[model samples]
Target: MSHAPQAILARPALLFLVLVMASACASRPGTDTLIPFGATVPGAKLVKLLVATNRSGHEGHSAGSASTRGELRFEELTVSIPPQHQPGEIEWSKTTVRDPLESFVVVERQPMNATDFQERLNSRSNGAGSTGIFVHGYNYNYTESVFRLAQLAADSGSLDVPILFSWPSDGAVAGYVADRDAATYARDDLVTLLETVGSAQTRRRRLLVAHSLGGWLVMEALRQLRLKGRDHTISKFEVALAAPDIDVDVFRKQLEVVGKLNPPLAVLVSTDDRALGVSRRLAGGRQRVGAVDISDPALREAAAKADVRIIDISSVTAADGARHNRFVQFVALQATTVVQADAVTSLQKAGAFVFNAAGNVVSSPFDLASRALSSQ
Candidate 1:
């Protein structure tokens, strides 16, 4: 019959969907704009980061899919943030000529061997407060992940040594399945990086932050560590997953293996995360952990029982339309402000809380009673 006419009409709809997805992922600058301009600009802040990755190409500037061998590489970079930069924003160069005063610019890049990398990390770790390791989500190139970590450190005014663990995301909107596979492939390398960080002979704390698909990789790595009886290494860090893209059932199973830590794991979730909504649909209608409704009594009870702190960040406005990056805004606010003890204590417990628009933490009466009971 005449099904050809129906197929012809559907092409435009598919094209429109492709364009929307491209626009959403193309808002940030790509690796072509990552050329280093050695000159420094006055009034600009410099952020230094240690980066580890499993992607092929030069150590200083590698991206795309993982290397066939899946070997680890290391590099250090210094990025200059413009003085006029706002909190929770990475200002890309508007013109071809990168401007350090108006946008982010790479000032220095150095490649390091494994021994040198570990020694450098140890030097930074000795008695220097906490170290922060950031694992970026899907659709991120090497340059974007590097700059975003630099921006986050500068915006939050954090004193922790910043480290970036860049997995092999091809950085394409249409490469979701490929990126997920790459994330799974990079699990061992992530574990190796964690072991190196944990081996440092110091008493400083460590914070591991993963977003979206990176959350899945992190959970798998932690499960591996638990199976290997590396509890001491796991004890050195606190973990936070923001807008994680793992299926609800999968996350529960992973939690069963990963078990609980000294400070409970923090999961930053938003009900209206459009990116996760798409992921949920792609996963055969299975709910993504990051988009779960925290107000649901059953979900809250499960989270509490698992010693997980689920913080609903739906009240915080996202810089992007997708609402997937609200965690960046939340971190900026939490880092800049001196949160009160009650709010801090509530967050430390296993329950649900809300991050209000005013950058304050709100706890429920049930959580308060739980805290009180735990204190006794």
Candidate 2:
């Protein structure tokens, strides 16, 4: 008799218990801290974002518990990043009153109709600059997602327009199942956002970046577009998935439907991602795409055939303990134009590559083989 089935069943149960205990010991910020302070400080940088959400509003703030009448809503937000801000960190205030000089604060907010949102996006993209739409992962509230995009935009200094595609996440460690369902429920709405951006008359490039479960949502929306014979819409954007928590087989199936994108899809992966490690166990011990060993010839061959670029970032230290947020650090490193230029030059082709701790890109297989032979 095989114990593999029993082992697989026990792993998820064990992981759940461990996660519950960890959650109990974790310190979380108060939801009231999410409120906008509406203040500005000298030497602070401002990041303006076009926000679209399916989250329901409560007391003038988007609540994490409900959807917006089963439809998408649009808004514009301006976030103030403190002068003392550090890369790869979202500095939250310890007190209810946020200090603009020390913490990230929202200074301006404007509710917009769909028409106004598209028009504003069009105007921003009328020049040669690109638009970036970020989809936040699980365990994120509306304000958290908004500020995260703001941080990325402020740090990278690349995006002409940053848009946040905020889905309803319960924002609790124990609410993982609910967040998964919410991500699935928001798929059609995501397609709408993609279509809205793709239909613009402007010729500017579009970049869609999704993290963790948001990667699943983005793939599903792209698949939906493909099924509807709207491949052109999918081709309009460059895609990237960071620390995606998708099962490997499921990702393969998704890629089969997504087909070959013009610029291909860039997948930022880390073998040491503890969050994806937990996800893999919960998924019947199936491997997750984000945690796959990129140096494996099989994975490299598959990625090449599918027009995907696998970027292994295991060498970079993560700001978070789980090591699932190295992408933030990666973008922060790109803030230095020299590193940005070099990294882009190295990643122009579709295959596996390693982003080292020193902000250099090396061919993954070559790097690993050389290290192995040297050790031998």
Candidate 3:
């Protein structure tokens, strides 16, 4: 009789073990393959982005980062829009999702080039006549860059045609030197991309956004464009460099040339940035342009001469580990609000407050943290 009671007790223990194992398996996603964050909201489709990359794609994974700079190619992918998502990681629920960076799943993907992209762009009704190009920085693989551009586009909802210009970055912090050379080699290719876009059947609002080292590429490309007397061929929109990693002295010369284009060039810099500090050290004690305070006498004149407006976001709280790309966070947060498109002018109209060269002070700064994190 005692043996019978012991056996009965063991049955429940076995059942508990099975339940625990089931839960563990359920926790993991269906596929081991990385997917982009969040499922689409009910009755919604995917957010598509067109891509142009100079990185070699014949590697093991077609979407993997290019090992060497290759011929520039065009492709497109679509990302699902997760309803009620905040910037960065999310909780698992109907209203939220798991971290976006964990996996990069896409609803649809296609092979395309500049001509096909233009056709699709012409067909789009939302924010027509606006083409935004995003240049990624160091330490980004190809997949990561594409998904991020998708996230930025979906979140901003301002871009009519979202284009990702991904150069060959070694995708490692230690690979800075290699990335620099790679970016140099890709400079002319960037010009070609720009010219192709410029020659599109329709003229549109051309916006360029470069982050970190990619900002260096933008300056170089613009300088080249100006040198070739080709900068005027394409209509330009507002240019924003978020935590640019360009050398201070070099950036000044770049500003001298690009400023002639005279579309508002906004340098979104933060003094609290730690990544720029490392980049500064790498540049032999020279501070990167993004780390330069707007009040710094050196850059203030350049800003004034170039008609560049300094939006000092050093006061904004950073959720990402590195305080470098605060511009992306700001865009993501703005999407949460009922703000509509035309985001270039939205910065001033949103009453977010801008700081002049008075040492980059935010006049009447409001708490954007709580607002950014609020349940959407």
- Candidate topping TM-score: 1
Which residue pairs in candidate 1 collide? Answer: none
lDDT of 1 by residue, 1-376 (tens): 7785456335543344446556656665645565568977888999889999887774434332233335789988889999898877888888878889899888988889899889888878766355778899988777778888887787655435888999888776656777889998899999999999988766566778889999999999999999999998898877888899999999999999999976788888999988888778767779999999998999989989999988888987787756777777766664455555567666767988777656556322112222222443
Model 2 CA lDDT for position 277: 81
Q: TM-score of predicted model 2? A: 0.87
Better of 1 and 3 by TM-score: 1
Error of 1 at 254 (Å): 0.5
How high is the lDDT of residue 201 in model 3? 56
Candidate 2 backbone collisions, by pair: none
lDDT of each: 0.77, 0.77, 0.62
Model 2: which ten-residue window has the lowest total lDDT? 364-373
Displacement of residue 224 (Cα, Å) in model 3 is 0.8
Task: Tell me the tens digit of each residue's lDDT in model 2 across 1-376.
Answer: 8886456436655456446535532655555554567888999999889988888773365342343335688988888999999976787776767899998888877889899998988877777666788999977766678778888887776676898998888776556777889988999999999999988877666788899999999999999999999988887888888889898999999989889876668888999888888888777799988899988999999888998888888877677766777788777765442433455555666788887656565322111112222222
RMSD of 2: 6.7
Question: What residue runs in model 1 are displaced by over 4 Å at the alpha carbon?
Answer: 1-21, 25-30, 60-70, 335-338, 362-376
1 or 3: which has the higher lDDT? 1
lDDT of 2 at 281: 74
